[model samples]
Target chain A: MSQHAQDYTPSEREEHQAMHLLPVRRADLPFLISLALIAAVYIVLIVGILAAKVFYVELPLIGEVFTNPGYRYAVMLSLISCSVTTILSLWIAVPAAYLMTRVRFPGKRLVDAILDIPIVLPPLVIGLGLLMLFQTPPGAWIQQYVRFTYAIPGLILAQFMVSCAFATRSMMASFAEINPRQEQVAVTLGCSRSQAFWMVVLPEARRGMIPAATIAWARAMGEFGPVLVFAGTTRMRTEVMPTTIFLELQVGNLGMATAVAVVMLITSLVILVLMRVAGRGMRMM
Target chain B: MIEFQDVSIQLGSFALEHVQLHIPTGTYAVLMGRTGCGKTTLLEAACGLRPLQAGRIALMGRDVTDLPPGQRGVGLVPQDGALFTTMTVADHLGFALRVRKRPRKEILARVEELADWLGIRYLLPRKPHGLSGGERQRVAIGRAMAGHPDVLCLDEPFSALDEETHADMIALLRRVQRDTSVTVLHITHNRNEAQALGDHVHVLKDGVLERQDPKLWKK
Candidate 1:
């Protein structure tokens, strides 16, 4: 049996890693079982769906959806909208997160609480709120110039509304990891307040920002509720991957819907790989 | 020159009330204190990095109680060097010059001059990740002095160095103080460090400054 795989002794690195972990015993079996069960629940939900799609659906149908012209446009639109939304979200989140971290004022805590409103609220409700805003007099007047409701801009707005909160939260966590003393030293070294922030704090926070942007992009890419409600599921105009799957399923096209789901799964995996690469690149820097 | 008159500030669980401290121009003053004493707090307040509730800070004989850190003309090297991990050693040295939009040639010359004086010319191109404690501290001191600051504040900058490196750093600091005549307010726990480098020594205990002659530092 190949020399019993060299006896499988733990390496020094493994022993060191185990040093940090709490001691395990027979009494911990129940806790370990519970942990395994919880992990299994999550794995089943994520992996099970992809497995089901491959097993129940025809391979040619999945391939056809992959190359479909309508599905292709949906993918392009989703990419464009999500990328734009991520950029806009970062533009707002970076400064907002920095302000939240550094500055204090009356109602600062309340402002923090308000930021969570978007995250806590249902995605569809956020979309409905955006739609309701355009129905208001000022929103309608502004709409004359900015085309927001049921338009491509509205689709981006919906994704941004849902994704920006996550972006801000992630960036805030990123900025928090940096010690405030770094900025103080930068200022003492003759950099102005803004200079210290831009040159020192921002560059140092890049690692955190990468995850923030990636999470926002992924959230935008997969966003359905807000886009459906605010942007509308217009064919070829606003139909994204999630909406495409919905429309196909409405007509009892199981194979088509499964194919669209597979596309999303593949795209998500690709994004995850890209995120890992970016994280590694950031660490190298 | 640096002066803190009746300075009062509360930081976390520590509080300083009616603390008075003064350092004359060109004097190498060390504030020695036990761990958890408000030594770094005092240093920060004096440098305009921390706000004082009720008192004034004067640098170079002018009131700077309300000035921001950059405008107060004070340079600070915090404990652990706090070097920007993203920057090369040269960038750290030239950061102040670049901020002020100084000429490229001038910035280069000043950085080169400092690198030579600090004996860190070899480290200019390298980032801080591979630097030893002594090298990091040297870079930190160089960065602080790069601005040609009116007053230089150092918070235990040499504590991380080995005994030999520590002694070398003390000599280097004394040489820098003599060459530039910049006022210095350093805080440290090491009595030997205070004895070797301080022209005037002070002890901070129970949130107050008590002046002592440098001769008594070893005792």
Candidate 2:
């Protein structure tokens, strides 16, 4: 036996055997390095962009984002809308995603593809579709009652239209990851379908809710084209962070635009971090 | 009593056609088959988890073909235990009682009784994530039997246990059936399991189920 082989303790020998079973060849080094280098390039670019925003932007302008009433209203609107949208998205997404994952109905494939339309379709098209929908007789009828065109409600509708799709996708993957047998066992234990969902499926899928909400909130915060087209960028009225950035840029206030973008980046990062921490906490339980 | 009258089920490329099975009241019946011979499919169909293409399922002499799983009065212990990850062992034991809206005192008494019967009184406070394979299966059995259904179905519950644990589980199940006198339909490919626990044995081969002597476990 080789010296290394002779030196290995029982645990070490087992690990060594495992390592040998899935041996990596030295010739694969260049291929592995190339794959890692490609990944690093994307990582570097993301960090580089974020760093540029933090470094190049003035602090006073960012301070104005909090102090200025127009920006303040926009920030408050963005926070409120994103929060509302996240809640609304989950309300729809959880049940819809669960159904999509569990049920097999006619036109299920078509329904699945249609559900993904907002995710795959350009944001502008979603806004345009909303825009065109409100012009139809049914849309006009609903508009007469609620008024969604170029209004605060329009902002939420546009965000929900797109954000709910993402939330649903996340939830669908979550439900799919859970074993159907759990729900079956619950049913056999005298739980009705809805009761099984509430008791067995929902609790297991709870950890997944954080990421779904995070994704929905992040997508809603970053939403630009849909909000712009569906809800006009009216300052202090229908303005949000994304629209604020657009309005600032249109007026050639580069500092203000960068500041708003930075604020958004920070908020999204905080949410992402909180979500990851909460997910970890749930798993620990 | 549990009966499958001319049951037919199709899942993707795999199918079980015109399958008939019956387990008499208070008897332990084990169904043996090859790995992909639709053992679980049959179990699921009996539990009303799967939609039957043809035939009726009766539990306690009631036709459960049109009934949903929850209304079928059946209890299931799946292969993996499929315990609720978020619930404690006490919660799992009390789950069916809670679902049926039984009195809280009654649930507590029953949960304690089941925990004691399964030799898992110490595990009642813990979750399934920290359990051993034998413990999880015991919890699954407790959860199923907690419901006090007309029939209980166990699908390969002992397939993942160590030898000692397997033997313990076999003895525990035998004792459980003896004590409760609940009708049971257990599925296993292991001939030893069938021989050990089966009061009646049925083998599924080439889409057909045929009764065999419980003592005869020939190929």
Candidate 3:
């Protein structure tokens, strides 16, 4: 400041700098204004909701809901059925994915198109179709061997039909990313077809498979329409978490419904985080 | 000895017809061809990777045309080095040995020996992605050699290497061939490589084998 004061007065120095350095033009003003507007809107919508204390609704007493033996049984049945659905979907989907990706057979494209039908069809329609099939004469004759209509088996079947397609689609993409030539090389080297697949292809595709499984599990856990129609939303029999939320909301128990929704949100968030981590590890591999 | 007697195949638009070739035991032969001339298909036919529509492939006087690649006793190093991405260099070299139920110690020793021979001993612990093109080719060759196959088919093994490295590789392969006495069918589009490495060169153009001029290729 002493050196500058000695050289020139503040006004003279400002004039000198202005003469050398050009002022910013107004050409970029529109872009900056648009960016600022977008940022403001985002902050008001996203940050405002997250920051608002009104959105934070507290849970009511759990004692009343837990005391009801029917709720407890419903929860237990949901956990068991969802777990079974996840396991069965994985077991069936893995092989289906592998075969669909690796093998060449007659009507391969037809089988692929058929597998896709479950994913695109409305779950309610799927449930209705299942209902008609299991209740009708030809389907009823088959049902004698295995109970399906309005039973636990029907719920599991509906869930499986809805979720297996999702699992297969994800796993198929994962399997496709892996080069089949790797498996061919392994087989030529000495491993049998199965051995080569298990050792070489599976390990490489494991990361993709994990997320597929997780997605399937998450979808199965949250499934409602099919389970309701196929298994019937019985109080202590086939009532899963979503069914519980629906039943509670119908009876005008807002607090309990919100609680179930919160639980579902937490579960979904945890699964999504796990999937992200798995996907990242897969990329590193 | 490996022999192809009037072998022919048609894959979509590409075709290889009436191809007859022979490789005497312990001699290194090169298949010289331009692109789209069905050189790779010939190799595939010889290795049992592709089915032959006509004619037969005989390995050590046994008809192996219908046999699978594993049962053909022929090792193939594909053009891209095709090393298993999930396995380490040592694991790849020892793959066939492990599949054949060889002892772990023996497999390790052979892998180390081949790795050292190829000047890639230090790279044994690394994965294929960590290797240079030359190093990958070395590992592919080592893996093929590890199987102790009757014949080795190298499909443009040095094509990906730089000129200097390619020269070095040619010398290395010659030494390896002299030592092992393993019959090799080296496929390449480069005329210099064919002349340098081949004891006999079969020139292929548009899937047809041209008459060879023995005097054109010198030692």
Q: Compare the candidates by lDDT and give the number of the best one.
A: 2
TM-score of each: 0.90, 0.92, 0.82
Top candidate, metric DockQ: 2
For candidate 1, lDDT tens digit of each residue in B22-119? 88988999999888888988888877778888988899999999887788888888887888878899999998888889999999999999999999
Could you tell me how far off, in angstroms, the CA of residue A158 lies in candidate 1 after the best superposition?
0.9
Clash numbers, per candidate: 0, 0, 0
The residue-by-residue lDDT of candidate 3 on B1-219, one tens digit each, is 779899889967877888888888888888887777788888878877777889999987889888878887877787777777667888988888888899989998988888888888899888766567788788878887888788889888777778888888899889989988888988998888887888888888877787465457555
* Model number 1 iRMSD: 13.0
Lowest-scoring 10 consecutive residues by lDDT in candidate 2 chain B? B210-219
DockQ value for model 2: 0.44
Say which prediction, candidate 1 or candidate 2, comes out ahead on lDDT: 2
Rate residue A79 of model 3 by lDDT: 64
**Clash pairs for candidate 1:** none
Over A99-142, each residue of candidate 1 has an lDDT whose tens digit, in order, gives: 99987779999999999998899998999999999999999999
Instruction: State the lDDT at A163 in candidate 3.
Output: 82
Compared with the true structure, all predictions reach lDDT values of 0.85, 0.89, 0.78
Regions of candidate 1 where Cα sits further than 4 Å from its true position? A1-38, B10-15, B217-219
Q: How would you class the docking of model 1?
A: acceptable
